[model samples]
Target chain A: MSKLSVIDNKRCVGCQSCMFACSRRDGNAGLSNSCIGVKSASGIEGDLTVVVCRACADPPCAKVCPTNALIPKKGGGVRLQKTKCIGCKLCQQTCVIDAVFWNKEENKPVICIQCGYCVGYCPHQVIKLLK
Target chain B: MNAFNDTLSRVLYIDVKNKKFWVTERKDLFDKYIGGAGVAIKLLQEECPSGADPLSPENPIIFAVGPLVGAFPLASKTVAMFKSPHTGDLGESHAGGRSAVAIRLAGYGAIVIKNASDMPIYVAIHGNKVFFRDATTLWGMGSSLTAARVMREREIGTGYRSIMRIGKAGENMVSYASVTVETYRHFGRLGLGAVFGSKKLKGIIISGKQTLQVTNKKTYKDLYDRIYKEAVNSQVMKKYHDIGTPINILNLNNLEALPTRNLKQATFEYAEKISGENIAQNYLGKRVACAHCPTACIHLANLREQYSDSPYFYKTTFVGYDFELLYALGSMLGIEKPEDIFMLIEEVEKFCMDAMSSGVVLAWATEMFEKKLITENETDGLNPEWNNTKTYIAMLSKIVNPPNAFYKAMAKGVSHAAEIYGGKEFALAFNKNEMPGYHTGPAAHLGFLIGARHSHLCNAGYSLDQSLLLTQDVAPETIIDKLIDEEAFRQILSSIVVCFFARGIYNLDLISQLLATMNINYNTDDLKRIGKEIHAEKYRFKCREGFSFDKLEIPGRLFETPEPTQKINKEFMRAALNYAKEKIKCQ
Candidate 1:
């Protein structure tokens, strides 16, 4: 089992390289489809907060899903079944961490599948892939 | 979402007076000049009328992001063009943060804000929607930080959003006011904030989630990886990420090139106290980066201040510092202590005033006070002296919120203040814009006179002063030629809108490859030609706005200070200016 983990949020410089990388995996640029997000903890001068799926053991988003579109992954997190989704955005509200991002064009939730693609782009080693 | 080609040429225009907005496809402009400074200058020409008052409604505020924005690392700069209230000519300032990315992803290659509002307002752009929110309550905020935070609360989209606002200095239309971006980064030079204030624009919040697609995905990935590797591993980038730009303090001080106390002397004796190493070791709170940039160059220092009423009660503040800030508020003001400099930094940030201009203005005021040219009556009972952090802090506020005639005049800028106060000889301003941190040599001074923006970054004359002139003697004509070529090439870089710090990583060859991946093809010569054309366009606008090469002021203070290179005189500068004039005329 594999999952993405925050090594230390304090080391984050708010570069958003992870966010850009996350979006780039689907052969595009910009933050529209990024499953991960980063923003200032306070103002830009303060610590940066990196928000991503924590890959819960028993994901509440999966349990609350009316269509069963979000399937709970083995170790943690959830996998999306595009055919089952109804574009309801219930998973976006159910997630405690607010890590479930929205694909506005498709009108669906974008969840990380624990690919760990962003780990290599974190210049400060703020995040890592746990296996 | 449209294709990248179509979306990249879209220009969004906003009229604050009529509360109307429109979008147009300007493929012609983008194709000819590229984007960022190039497209911005063209838009400025089309929008701003000739001989119009800079602080008047006729002047347009232009913000443009380049082709590389949102797609490349270090390509995070947004070019802001307006008629400078400070220079009364071409005003172009670049800021880093999420501004460039936000503007680009909002589906605009450029945004033009025209006319003025009758009342204070903040414009929020979320994708294609534009909201002219009444900012009556948010107006008159003490700090720009507070204004931005307030706007942040009212807005949506966190990671993709950028908030830009002005403080009291801008509200009062101080000639050297700056627009703070994301708290730490800023459109910091030539009074863009004054323009914002003139238009009654309190703040601007922009956010978008648009995605860009490139046809050749494999090539794009390879190019991105190469650039990323270079940015992460380069010696230059490492220095920027580690100690940041303040590391220049010690080096410049050693070379006796750092301007100290209104250029009365070239070197500061207490440079070590405010050195980058000392600050990074003692007070570095954290480092932050502009969106999409791998090198986090912006350094914030933790400044803890205990309330006077309660000794134990304290508030910790984060103040961003750079080479310019260190030179301006630290050495230039003779404030040696890091804490005092931090306090001064905070004061300038609160007022949203350009740190360099504020320091130099105060430095001139201090010298004038010493000379008895201006007394306490003029200073409102406050005596200003070198290294007096408390008085300087007080004066910073007064400059924003003027209590008397003297402070009001000072707010106009050093050139205007000196004209009124009889200190023109010592006034360290180039074409009405305050001198940057460099007093390197003739090249640095000449660059200020000739550069389109009258800024150090315009042509990096200080870099040339150190790299070429300091090592060996170079002819004035040769130096002028080199300066022009460098400045012209930089026009292309600014068009791409990449942070100038990554110029090494994105050379002409790499830029060609990067642009190719974006489906914009240009050979080295074609790129150079476009660069030259863009620079000439900016100069044409400057000329139309009453800029004259022969009439450019070479301040007497520049001669008083000793530079590392050869001593520069008025005769030398005049000859160089004449040569540059002839060369530019031919171009």
Candidate 2:
């Protein structure tokens, strides 16, 4: 089992390289489908927050899903069962860290699948995969 | 058209007077000019009325991002074009933050804001919907930082947004007012803020989540990885990530090229105290990067102040500082302390003014006061003396609010102030816009005088001076030729909208390769031709706006001060300008 984790988020520069890479994993060139998000924690003068799935063992998002669309993975994160999802957004609401992103065009949840594609793109070495 | 090209060619035109917005397919413009500065100048010519007052509703504001913006590293800058209230001609500025990515993802290669709004408003573009939100409350905000924070709270798309707003300086229509992008970055040259003020626009909030598909996904990914690796590994980029741009302070000071005390002296006596290494070691809080950029070059300094009223209470502020900021607010003012520099930087940031212009203006005013050309009454009882941070801070506010006619004239720029006050000889400005912090040699000044936007970055003459002129004596005509060629080449880079810091990383060959991945096939020769054409077009707009190389005033202080080479003079400068003018005409 493996999980993606922020190594030292203080080093993060809010470049969104991780977010871009996550989106690029789908062979896309934009942020429409990225599960990761980075933004200023306060304003531009303050620190940045790199928001990714925290990989909870007993995930709250899975419990709230009406159709069990969010299947808990072996490590901690969950995999989306697209057939079961009805786009109610219950999983989005229940995710404590707000990591269950949305596909606005498809009205589907875009959860990080713990593939670790973004780890290679973190220029500052702020994120890594724990195996 | 390909999907990428189709999306990249859509231009959003907003008519604030009519409260109407529409998208036009500008594939022809993008096809010809690429995007950013190249496409923006074309749009400006089409929209702006001839000889229109820069602050009038007729002067249009255009923001353009390139095709490489969201897809490539370092392609993070957005080119802003308008008629400058400062220079009264072809106003152009570039800002890096999230602006390029936001504009790109918002599905617009360019956004042209036309006419004046009926009331104070901020335009919010979320995907396809455009909302003109009443910004009456936010209009007179004291600090641009506060305005940006308020806008952040009010707007949607926290993760995917770029908020650009003006502060009191902009709202008051100061000629050198800048539009603060995010909090750390800005369209920090010319009078874009004054243009925003004239239009009654308080801010613009842009955010979107549109997906972009490349012609070849494998190629894009491979190119992206290679570029990313190169950016991180490049020694030049590593220098930026470490000490950032402020590293130039010591180097310039050592070379005796740093403009100090209003160019009265070339080197500051206390340069080391406020050097980049000093700031990074002592005050550096964190480093940040623009969207999609691997090199996190933006350095913010932490200044902790204990409340005088409450002994135990302490407040810390993070102010972005760069080489230009350090030069403009530090050495140029003769300020010896780094903390004082930070304080001045914060005030300038709060006012949303161009730091270079603000510093040059204050330096001139200080010199005037020293010469007894003007009394304290002119400064509203504040004496603008060198090394006095308190007076400078107060003066910064006065420039924004403008208590007296002197402050009003000063707010316009150093050149305007000198025109009225009889200090035109020492007014360090090129074509009415304040000079950037570079007094390297003849080429640097020549670049400032002849460059399309009258900007140092327009051709980077200082870099040329250091690399070429310092090594050997070069003919003025040859220098002009080199400057023209470099400036023309930069037109393509700015169109691609890469941060000039990454100029070495994104050369013509690499740019061609990257564009190939996106299905916009243009070889080096085509790019070279287009670059020259764009440069010519910018000059055409400038000439139409009444700019002339022969008529430009050469600052006497530049000749008096000792640059590294010590060969700069009026005659050589005039001859170079003439040659450049003829060369541009031939082009």
Candidate 3:
């Protein structure tokens, strides 16, 4: 079984420290390349939702990839092959969770690799690794 | 590297006396200070001669942003450092908006302005070029809001532009003047606005749009999304977004730490009237946000009321209120009416004064009146009363311009006024800077006294004291030790230009990982070592300016008023000071 990044929204402070950390992990100092999304409901923030790839057994993103760039990994989830991607965003539009973040600079869709780097930065114990 | 390629291109050095501009790329300084307040502090220490008059032409004004500013999320604050006209010591303030982004994108890490202009002028920084335009028309502007509106319309920049302009208070050089950015947010502490005024610079307008570079693009995207998710969904930011900082009122009131009626008492008698819940229920009109901030914690409310003089008339005014503003201008001034507090806040904003200091000054004036120090004659025939928003507004306006002796005295800040009037004991200031809202325990007071910059966040001593109260009998030494450690750690965070709000999220291990990604090598031990060094450097500057923690005045009122942990003893406080002196000496 492949591990997935799990989120517990209750403990998050919305500092965006995790976001910066993720960007730094990629050798960037900005947020343009992050794959996760956090948005508050209405103007109130008590109920914040953390959205990330669910790493499904049968991912919808893989089915919509025209060039078959997105292939299911041996562990459990799907992976994107940048060389095969035609800059087509059909998979991005089809992903129900909106986990795929599009990089405007590169014209490519970014998805969470299920790496646990972000988990340690979450001060609230909101993010956990799930098997 | 070309000026365009290097992030630390060149510090724009402007000598106000000759109105000359020059640039020097201090790469070594950038590598060490890492820009923002860290760089500003170094510049202040080097340029500002000892005992240089803070309001004189000799005083240097510095504006700085970090290396990661334009390239990152949450790295959005521009730090302004100067010799405070109020504190007579190290003065530092930070404001968020498009200021940091604009400065960084404009390709400079620091802008230092020295000397005074013979006439009013405004500075415009466009890429590599700098222009100083005559602001004869904009001078003596009564309202900063109007100035910002006019500048926004006239300047060739918008959206990503930042306008930092002063109002009547600044032009008049009020001791606690603040520079307002984006019309609402302010670099609102010490007297940076006064420094601008001293330079005969009415305002500064900056704008830029430059794309930042990133390494390991794939990993960057993944991390960005992860952080954005947590920021938008985190419970820690919920309170800030919902009630804004005003929520601290309820929490502090419950803790019995709220400074009320000029620190005469801990909790206010009419605490409910000024609680965040009350303000949100009655007057929370709209919420605004800083640039690229997902939290949107800025709350501006409209208070509509029927005018007593007009038959069928109503006045609608927009006011921003938070915990510190409410505590300082409302309860601290003995004003219980929410509408009254809102009205006073509007007056402060219009004149562009530091709300905290203004409130403390008003409170001191009110106390002076009650004690019969000065009568109606000294007050220009206007009776100084508590909670009278109408009278308070009138007094504030008169003081900003100061047409008479009473108004002029009031303009000099509470500490100076108290010194002249012989009430230093209850002047309510730390290092000549007015106190913030936290008057709950020894931790808060001690933190303010000992913290390098004397800011609430330096060590958040009040919060520490509260935590200690819950756990065990916290000895004075334990409190001092904890505060020193926290303050040291915070120095490292600020050097990295990380916001204090994210302290919990950016632990030592996470910081190490993040730095690794940036190709900067550091570990937990490195952070501690660096933090200690930064803390020591700040103290070194403080000592150079003749600051002694042992010589620090512990206001007599603190001993009289019982705190949440119980009334602090003088002996214990003395012992704590002695220990702090030794600890600092060892550093």
Candidate 4:
């Protein structure tokens, strides 16, 4: 199983450098299509919680998808087939970590591909890419 | 250019008196001036009447975000311009939070607020719709945090939304009042909050979720990646993310340039207790970043207090502590304990007062009290003593709601207060605005005296002072030139409205690349030229406002104090300020 590991998120500064890296990979400069989410544990005074697709063995997000749009990859994470997909936000609710980010501009659910582009951008080394 | 981000060329004008707002496409202004301070200065020229009182409705508050704000890393500052109640000249302050991103996403290059509301109100902007909500109840709130919470409940947007509010100090129109942005950041200088108070503008909440399209998609992404990598990997940027800005405390102290006891001494004996390293080691709760900024330089101190009523109960709070805060509240006030400094900072934050000015004013008061200039009668039966946190905490409430004439004088700021109270020698202010926490030498003091805003943030003259002492003895003429040149270049950065922390990252070449994405093309030389022009434009506003370099007074205390760069004499500072004046006159 291949997934991004949150080694120690207590060190997370909530800079969201990784979040920008997430969307910029797809030539976007916003969080609209980003799968990863880094929110303050409560306020900015607390630790930041890095939420991304943990590459669940039997992902709940895929099980809850109304259509077969969310196809599981051989390694992990879900791949979307945009043609058959309906804009039902049930997949967003299914994920316990709320890693299923919604693209408000285009009603689509963005899931992590685990390409690990964000891992390189994190100066704190809080997140690491493991295969 | 990308269709999504094209709306940045639009400017939103809000007339609070008429209770009407309109949007106009000002691509012409954006084309030449760019956005942020650049465009705001032009707007200030056209809108603000000359010789208008800072607290009058004629003074318009201009908030501008640059093109690269939401799209580029470290481009997280929003420049707020208004007539300063303190300086009575060009009032400009930059704050980093969700302000820049929120403004850019709200689809405007600039938001011009004009006129005054008859009643207290807060404006909430969501996309195009502007709601002027009655904020009479929120007005005169004890803590700015409480008002922000009320606004949060009333306002719809979250996460993307920014809540900028002023507290009781602002309500009372204290000259050094700051507008608290979010819970941690602020437009914390030159009396922006007092202007908000005058307009009866309790706060502003802005939010939007619009996606921007890049002009050269491939090149934009590639360049974006390059900067991103450099920001996350560079040693300079990493320092900010690590210990945050409190790191400057130790460095400044080591150089014997950290102003303590209101410039009576250069370095504090107990500086190590409240330095960035100590704060991070002992009290650092968390580090946070401004919107779109990769470096999380903002450090919040974790202050936990035990509740006396309930045994085994503790209430933990987060108070932001930077080098400025430390130098002002800690060393300057003689508050050695880190916890005590954080507590004082929390009080300062709650009152929404500029911490630098507050510290300097308090220090001046302490000196006056010691000299028998001000008695307890003037202090409302409260003693003004150094290193006493309790006295200071009580004094803040009085500053917010000044009861007697003396407290009222203090509320005006150090310059005006000293003018009336007869302590002009040790007032420690530059051009009416209280001096910041720097005592490097002549360059540092001269920069404050001659700077457009009378702020260290205008140009880091302390850096020049340090290098000169360590390296060579540069002439006052050369020093003045460096200061002006630095101020001019910084004008470009502030025009772009990027945080000064990313000075290295957003150099001319990179700024050019970033502007390319917004379809505003300019080379390095063009940026430098425009930067100089923008600097002059701000001076034009200052000169129109009846400000002259000759009117600048360098505090005698600064001359008496000896820093690592040696004793700063009046003649040396006057020579430098005169040279700057001559240069401005020539321009």
Candidate 5:
């Protein structure tokens, strides 16, 4: 069994603090390359949709990777090898939840590694580990 | 160091009296201040003449955004600084929208408008070009919403652009007038709108599209993802997104800290009607957001009302309500009906009035009536009653236009109005700015008096006082010392262009880490040094303008009211004032 970061929308305040934290973890000062996505629907923020990699047991993103850059991880998820990635963006299109974010600067897909560092910063208990 | 070429641009200098525009590049200032309120403060200090009238041409109004703006997500706020027509001191307001991004993308670090225009005009900035268009047609438009719509229609760019315009209240030089940006968001404090009106400037429209670059691509991507995830999933962000700031109403009311009936009481009798839970259920029509903001905390709701004159039974009006607005216009005025408060908020927004100040002023008027300060002749045969939304709306219009003697006096704000009508003892203002709804403890009142810019959040002294009381009873001197230190530290955060809401996130260690990424290395000690310097600079300006902390007028009513912490001692407050003055002078 593998643990994945799950979002509870009810606990989110939409401050975007997590976005900045994610960008900072990657050593960036801005939000252009963050893997997580938080966007409101029709400007009504009562229900915020937090999009992150679901880390499926048999991932569709890994299967679609032409160069095999996205390999199956030990924890029932997939990991991206930037060196092997062809920047084909097949994984981005294949993911239904739109969790695989494309790093335009690196010409590679940014998938959540399940490091769970983001879980600590969520003061509202919106982000939780799911086994 | 120049990872983003679009970050650095020429500063626009506009002289309204001469009707001339010029651009000057000052990279040194941007490098040091990091723009936003930091740069605006420096510009105000440089341009504004000492003892100059806040509404006079001599007073300079500065608008600035940070380097992270336009390039980063959630960095979408513009900071405006001017000599407040209300406070008659350092006036600062920050609003989130495309305003900051538009200005940054338009190739400018800041815009400084000096002097007054001969006639009504609007400044239009599209990319690198700037034009002062005749806005005589738009002058005295009565409603800010109508003016914004007209400007939006005439403007070259739609969406991704910011249109900041004033209304009839501003044109009429109402002391608490505000400047509305993006139609709903406003620089809603200390009469920035009146400052614009005094300059004979009706509005400012800015639009641009420019890309920004990062220092490291791989690391930037990783860091960006981390921040995005937290922003979306964090509890703090969720609270803002769910019911918005109105949630504070319930918490504050439960804590028995909600200011009611002009601070005559602490807790509002009708807290349930104005709580976030009730508002979210009854109203909360839409939750709009600023450009690049994922949180979407803005709640704009439509209030349905029946028209007595027409065949149509009901009409829906769009209004934005938060805890502060609700408390100020609703409970503070003894208003229980949510719909009535909504209508009052709409009228205040329409006139481009600062809801906080407007509500406080109205509450003062109602109190004046109770005290027999004015008879039927003064109120134009209409009683200034509590919770009367219709009368409140009608009075607000009169205040905007000044049809009678009462309206003219009221338009000048509570401090001035009280001065004329002999109600200075309970004017509900500290250094000319109306008190915010946080009569929780002495810390709140003390914080308002000593805090830079006279805002509650500057030191959040009230919250500190509550914490101290909860832990153990502490001496007033000890509390004052802690508050002064906290306020000094907060100055550094503001100088770095960081939002006060993220104080916990941007602590000393985190700030050092964030700054290291920008190649600006500074430890906690350096931050303290810079914070103190900035605080001194602001105080220097205030002192030069004939401000005296020792001479601060403490309202007598504050002594009568028992705060959450208990009755505030007059001698204790006087000692705190003395301590604050000594600290500033020594610095």
Candidate 6:
């Protein structure tokens, strides 16, 4: 399966290479465009909690999207129709893991499309794409 | 030029006296000098008046990031420049946290802080806003880590902002204290923390978001992909990702270049216990990277400690460790065990002092104590014994707290301490900045003597020493020429604010390509010439501050110790330094 999973969180070093990889997939250079977010657990002192779309069977993000922009794919992950997205940000608030990232410049939601690009950048094997 | 072409043009000016702030467009400066150290030196020269005290109100703190910052990979350092409280001239240090990214995205090429605050404060920047928050509570905070915690909770913006703070030693204006960033990285050397403390500033918080633009999208993408692939495939980069800098412990020990027990020996018998392999095998819990850097070279040790008050309570502390620090706190101080070294580094972190200088001071004290140069009465009834972590730890507390006259002397660093305590022969400092953990040979010593900051990183003469291992022998003139050239080229790298670890990937050709994307035109020769120009400017500042080659001192301890190269002598070092001085004047 192409859907991503946080196999281990403790192994993460807060390198944010995965965040860059995600943004690079969307043709950007900085963190402002990334769909995956890695924030400190308790400031910069403790371990990092890697937040990314886990491709839930019944995604809350998809259900909260009023304009049907976030539709579930044939598999598990949700597909985004950019034109239909009204930028309500309701979907972003609904997700428990806060995986629905915002495109600050475009004012649109950046959802993971089940691509395994970021998994390659996680040197510690923290992120995985599984069946 | 348009705003996009002039991306690195904003300069934030903070007058700490009135706690007032303003911004000025410095495109004229950045256009000529580029950013980071290049721009920082110029700003320092313009902002700081001649004959001004390093700890006075006129000493301006200049922090700069380059054009490649936030726009390119591994160009992640923010260069800091001021009058050093340690050396009293041409202070320079660089830190890689979110600092470079935050400042760049906040739309400033450099930040200049002048005058001293009447009250303690920390600067908080978000977009164009600068807030002077009261830091009276944070001034005497037990550790820099706790202060960072309080500021982190108070500051806005997450996932991107940087929190830089000082600890008790800095508050006490200890000359070699450091300003720690993110609990791991630092504006680590040459008294940046003391400068911060002198200004009644506790820390700084920076946060912003402004997307970087490129001249040609396709060219940018192609170059980015090429560099990314090169960085990922590089064995050098992979090595950094694996064990980080602690990898040097075994290599330097094998070469007998690792300075141990204050250069009494070149190799530590217990090298393996504090090695990168050992750390990776046992305590390496995490590996963090600086902003926009794929090479996560920062290795943090996970130390499990039970509470002294409660047997059942345990806390796992993450302590960042690297080669220089491990050599300084571990081998040089005669701490054999990894846990003991980690604890020593932890103590250093708590006080926010320079690890290299701290270790040098302690070793000097220990050696003097052993030679019957001083009594336990001088050492506050604690024996200054090598390999005794307990005594060392107690001495470290005294160095920060400075409970007695001896501790007060130690707080000033090895040079000043030796000046007071009669260990000038074994002071182990160059131009007031303590020597790094390298006993390679003459080129290393010469580099320290002639280099702008007298820092090993200023001109990596240790590498030159190791190179001589294969070539057998070289003329002093040739060695001087080589190091001068290295220093000039490193000026450009620091101007670009790229981490020196990625020096292999960001070669001249690649650097040229990256600059082209940013709309600056520079070929290899142009880059080299510009590098020399920057070096000349920095030297001009140093000279203006009354630094001269004639006044530069070489510690007698260097010649007394035999190293791997075994080429160190007063005659060779004198000639090499003289040659470098002449060459620098010509440049």
Interface RMSD of each: 0.9, 0.9, 7.9, 2.2, 6.7, 2.1
Show model 6 residue runs off by greater than 4 Å: A55-91, A106-109, A115-117, A129-131, B1-6, B306-313, B453-458
Residue B442 of model 3: what lDDT? Answer: 76
Q: DockQ numbers for every candidate?
A: 0.81, 0.83, 0.09, 0.46, 0.09, 0.46
lDDT of each: 0.89, 0.89, 0.74, 0.83, 0.75, 0.84
Better of 1 and 5 by TM-score: 1
lDDT of 4 by residue, B1-587 (tens): 23444777799999998899999999888889888889988999888998998999999999898888777888888888988898888999889878888888777779999999999999999988999999999887778888887887777655566889999888889999999887889898788999999999999999875666787779988887787778777886877778877788888888888888877888889888888898899898877788777777888878998888998999899888788888888899988899999889999899899998899899999999999998999999998787999999999889888889888998989999899988899998888887777777778777887776454344668888887844677778888898888888888888877888889887898888888887789999999999888889999999999888878787778777777778477777777777888888722
Instruction: Give the DockQ-based CAPRI class for model 1.
Output: high
Q: How do all models score by TM-score?
A: 0.98, 0.98, 0.81, 0.93, 0.82, 0.94
TM-score of chain A of each: 0.96, 0.95, 0.89, 0.94, 0.89, 0.93
Per-residue accuracy of model 2 over B355-398 as CA lDDT, tens digit each: 98999999999999999999988989988899999999999989
lDDT of 6 by residue, B1-587 (tens): 37554448889999888989999999888878878888999999999999789998889999999988877778889999998888877889989988988898877889999999999999999878999999998888777888898889898867778888899888888989999888888887788898899999999999875567777767887777676666767786888888877888999899888888888888899999999999999998777778777777888888888879998999888888999889988889888888888888899999899988888889999999989998998899998777898898899888888878889988888888888888788888898888887778888778887786444344768888887743588999998888888888888889988988888788888888898888888899988988888889889998888888888888887888788887888888888878877888732
Please give me the total number of clashing residue pairs in predicted model 5: 33
Over A14-126, each residue of candidate 1 has an lDDT whose tens digit, in order, gives 89999999998987777788999897766786677889898999999999899999998887878999999998888889887889999886888889999999998999999
* Worst 10 contiguous positions by lDDT, candidate 2 chain B: B451-460
Over the stretch B154-198, how does candidate 1's per-residue lDDT look in tens digits?
A: 799888899999998898999889998999888977999999999
- For model 1, the superposed segments whose C-alpha errors exceed 4 Å read B1-6, B455-458
Q: lDDT by residue for model 3 over A1-131, one digit each (tens)?
A: 54646556754544444554554565555454667655443212124456778887888899889899999876656888999998889988998877887665578887778886767556556677776
Worst 10 residues of 3 chain B by lDDT: B1-10
Question: In CAPRI terms, where does candidate 6 land?
Answer: acceptable
Per-residue lDDT tens digits of candidate 3, residues B232-336? 678866777788888888888888888888888888878888899888988887665454455656677777878899979998766877788999998898898
The alpha-carbon deviation from the true structure for residue B457 of candidate 3, after best TM-score superposition, in angstroms, is 6.3
Badly placed stretches (over 4 Å) of model 5 are: A1-131, B1-6, B455-458
True contacts kept of each: 0.77, 0.83, 0.14, 0.51, 0.12, 0.43
